[model samples]
Target: MTSTTAPKPRLSIWMRIGAVLLGLFAALLLLLALFPWDALREPLNRYVSERTGRKFEITRRLDVDLGWRSAAVKLDGVEFANPSWAREPYLVRAERAAFDIRLWPLLSGRVVIPHLALTSPTLGLQMEEDGRRTWALGKNTSDEGTVPVIGLMEVDQGTLDFLAEHLGVDLHAGFSYDSSRGEMPLDFRIKGRYQRQPLMAQGRTGNVLQLNAAGQPPFPLEIDAAAGHTRLKAKGTVAELASLDGIDARFDLKGQNLGDLYGLLGIALPQTSPYALSGELRKRARLWEAAGLKGKLGLSDIGGDMKFDQSQKIPSLSGTLRSRVMDMDDLGPLIGLPPTERSAKAIEGVAPPPSITEVKRARRDSGRKVLPDATLDFERLRAMNADVKYTAERIRNVRELPLDKGSVQIKLKDGVLTLDPLNLGVASGTLAGAIRIDGAQNPAEIRAALEVRGMQLSRLIPKIETMRTSFGKLDGRINLSGHGNSVAGWLGNASGDVAALTGRGQFSNLLLEFMGLDGGEIIKFLLRGDRNVVLRCAAMAFDVDKGTMNSRSVVLDTEDTVFNVSGQASLSKETLDFVVRPQPKDKSILSLRTPLIIGGTFAAPQAGLEAGSLATRGAAALALGALNPLLALAATVETGPGVDADCQEVLAQAKRPASREAAAGAAKAKKQ
Candidate 1:
């Protein structure tokens, strides 16, 4: 003790200086804990601005609490400047924001915020066409230290706005948050538009902090939305806030028309009747998929698989879908038709539901809505490229048009869409065709080519007694081009050629007698219920100009007569006007009818003898337009004004190029 008393030769000067510095640091920390933080507001804001490369300011008040274990820094009326290119005045603004920092970390010049709270904050976000997002914040730099950890976060009555001009997206939403539970819970509501369609959603999320936590998998979410009459519900887990890099979900959808989903899913689809569906959804990296998809589309049952790849500059979709018997009317909404037919009960409180025919008449008379927004949805179309194929085992329950099965191949690249080889099975025949659509064009360019072969006349025209269960082969082709938003609009601006011909077949004696020059046969047909008459041939050809189809030639040859017809059908106005001239195969003194005229709309057709006919003084028959097969005969009929054809000659003439049998052969050859 006595030797140590030397006092270690008094403390070294350097050691004393170090001790003094340590005391000063402790005193500095104490001063920091007690000092008036209001005096340092300006310097603090400047420091933050310098570090974040954004302007920061506190407009109203600031409060600081320092209790080591429970320290906080609160500021009121704070705002951060937006990026130079942003449209908003501020990137973020808050009425009151606070941070709870760990004092121990601060001593080492490190920031460790255990909690952060924002009250009435507003945030702005944007995404450019080049894929740059405003929320990217700032460029990162390498540094060595323990990064700050935000344990809990809360937001009260906050709002966020986002825009993606190229994607036709402009959305705004309100949000709130609470972390009283183990996992931070969040609730949000959105109302605006996406891809130029109205959008709305409500949802809740949990474990949002996991988005930034180390070794965390994903957050849980639940959301529901209504797009027009379509309703969708989803619940799942997700990761990566900026990009859906990891996700898993279960979803269900219900709607009166499936076409409404075109807007919701940003896909091209024909309209369908009421439906319900459920499926599992997943995302990994840049791929999103919907698997085990099962649903009802219109009146048909459906199931399939779908995938979307978002890794590329442009998203692409690939999928395969199939269905059992589906009704063609299910596609009505695709053409801008309403989900349900409007009724007098809905408008004027009429008690009774309108009859199907009445509803149809009303719709036909009023015309369709015809593409509510005629402009092309270019963004939706160009947002992704697709390769999808759909097949239906049967297409049924439509009048006159019985399609047994069909398949369509859909391919899209950039803004162009192509449907190649759209094939459908008819009675014992087939209908094959293709359609091309170019959305890059201002008005959208459309071209279609369709061919029909080997259709049984009786099956094709079951309701027409004139066919009298006729057994024959039917064939035809249509090549057309137009520019517009819908079929109606396209036809209004169309140009095309249409032709059809029928092979040797039998007709109902009632039809032949009704149009014959022999009065005795007409009387006999009236007495007899029904009988078959030999049909030598039938043909028609037309050219479409501005929605009107002008006849080139029309002819029908039967055992007892040759009928030449000329007509024009207007698609825009839906009217048919035609003339029929009959030539008797055998001279008869009882002839009483000749040269009939047909005129009317598709809903109502009227036929009567023309003024110049020998029997013009008498009333004419009320049936005629049912003889639509005559439209293709325009190119083949060689009969002079008053010449009649022998059944043998007509049959021999049916062997020509435009004949039904020849046409069928050509179609078959093309397929082979």
Candidate 2:
């Protein structure tokens, strides 16, 4: 047994292999410890330069620490060149930088950086107006490359210069990190110009270490920025700062005009007066929303929720706006009208400091024109599409306009805008209709159809005591179509129908006498208290063509008199030519039944007697009186042979044919 044992517990195959592997591993470790990683500086630079299509250089030394799980890389005086078109020679530079990269992914030719640190680094970023960006590396303008996953980052006294001509931003900022701030470490301050306005901004964010962590704690953020007269303040948290993902923030914004935000936010909006708003801002992929909005737009208090979706080819905006009490003047800018003056306190809710100066606006020549003449910008309409709903429970500053509540469904698409169910509560009635504006058409085309129903005359003429006792309801409709770029222009070239009718009502005899210019009736009513006359029916219809309004039929029948009106008015010229002839039901000694002519410009209308007809009537009256005083009454008329108009037929004819057809179609569709 001793002899066999001594023959050697011959070493097993495993032991022999173990001893050889140990010797080889020791040699390999020794080699790695002494290896000159600096020798790879030129080769690595060339390889990176070739991959990125940019110059890469290591001006000083390079060192690496290899481990089983990861590798630590340190570079001294490294620079990465920018695109040839860039203003700066280098896109990024660092005096000293270091990175800890995971080992496993390297086997698959992937880079996974666990940590990155930079000392005295500088970065230059730029974007051309044509949408070219220097940061899009590899192909210079191409965004076709995998970005390395970075876990944590640290920067010391970093400087960044960013320019984006399209957005009108040229900024120079300083960035730094302070570990003492705990979860919030990154801080920045910037001063430059945004939207061609002076800009100053300061912000702070959570530690970069948590930027990509799974189930990461919210990245705290706070920013206060001001540009020109606009100011923005936000405080919020982001789930991931890299892509601005999962943002939930509260923000306050103040500006001169809402439309001015287009260049900054890329959202299309109509021009508006000075405004201050606050809301909760959120982002989910390509959708950005401002919710719980409440603020002041000029003297109007506004509340709404607005959403912007960038996923669409032309981008879209949709929102619901509501106001408990809306000031009508605040809507002027939306329709290209001048804003009326209002107390600043009405908008700000407080007095401003003396340092703030009120902005002055140049006065436009009114020329006593009743219609608005401001030109519309079709380009703005073509920029984006929209669907919005607005409702006002009560209206203000409508002084004598008899407006109450209002609501409109606004839709815009492909340069065309439609306002369906544009409703206004007026004088205990409703003015309901639809309006379509095709801005895509050259010079633009507008079509409008409106209906008025149950408008009480008592409420309509609130200032007139005689009207207070009248129980009359007015019904009317307007159907118009035109091509223009302004409200005035549209009406000047408009082709349409305007009709109004009233049935089974009463009129003040005194008022009708004055309107008909009956001197005898006026004197009689003055002697005896004014009395009401039974109104059988009153109807007026106009057919408009090429801006000229021709009276199709106009008649007013009452127990006391029958009036017929005939004339043609020119909307383009803003002139009127009308004649009213009254036939009295009874005769009087002083009756002067001469026709009355109304002719003049809308700005300065003139009303006078038809002198020739009056002279003829007077001569006839005198001749008749010479024969017999009683027979002279013939000139003044005695028999009121005016037949009553078919109330139903008159009202039906007053409605425009186009509108009637549309209503029928809508009803049919609803039934189907």
Candidate 1 displacement at residue 137 in angstroms: 8.3
Clash pairs for candidate 1: 539-632, 539-633, 540-631, 540-632, 540-633, 541-631, 541-632, 553-634
Structure candidate 2, residue pairs in collision: none
RMSD of each: 9.5, 5.4
lDDT for each residue of candidate 1 in 213-249, tens digit (9 for 90 to 100): 3355677878898765667799988765535556799
> Over the stretch 1-672, how does candidate 2's per-residue lDDT look in tens digits?
355434545577778999999999999988888999999999999998898788999989989998999989999999989888888787789999899999999787566787888788898988787656776645546442434676666676688898887777899889888878666678889999988888999988764534454575667888999887678999998766566767899999987678877767767787776778999999977788999999987777789999988888999999999988888667766776555556233445333211112222223533445566778778778888999999999987776667789999999999999888799988788899888888999788888888889887667777655443575788887777778898888878877777788877777878777766666778787888788888888888877775777776688878777788899888877889999888776655455667889998886789888999889988998999999998777887634444555667766665543343333322322221
Best by TM-score: 2
Worst 10 residues of 1 by lDDT: 343-352
Q: Tell me, by lDDT, which candidate is best.
A: 2
Alpha-carbon TM-score of each model against the true structure: 0.69, 0.81
At residue 164, give the lDDT of candidate 2.
83
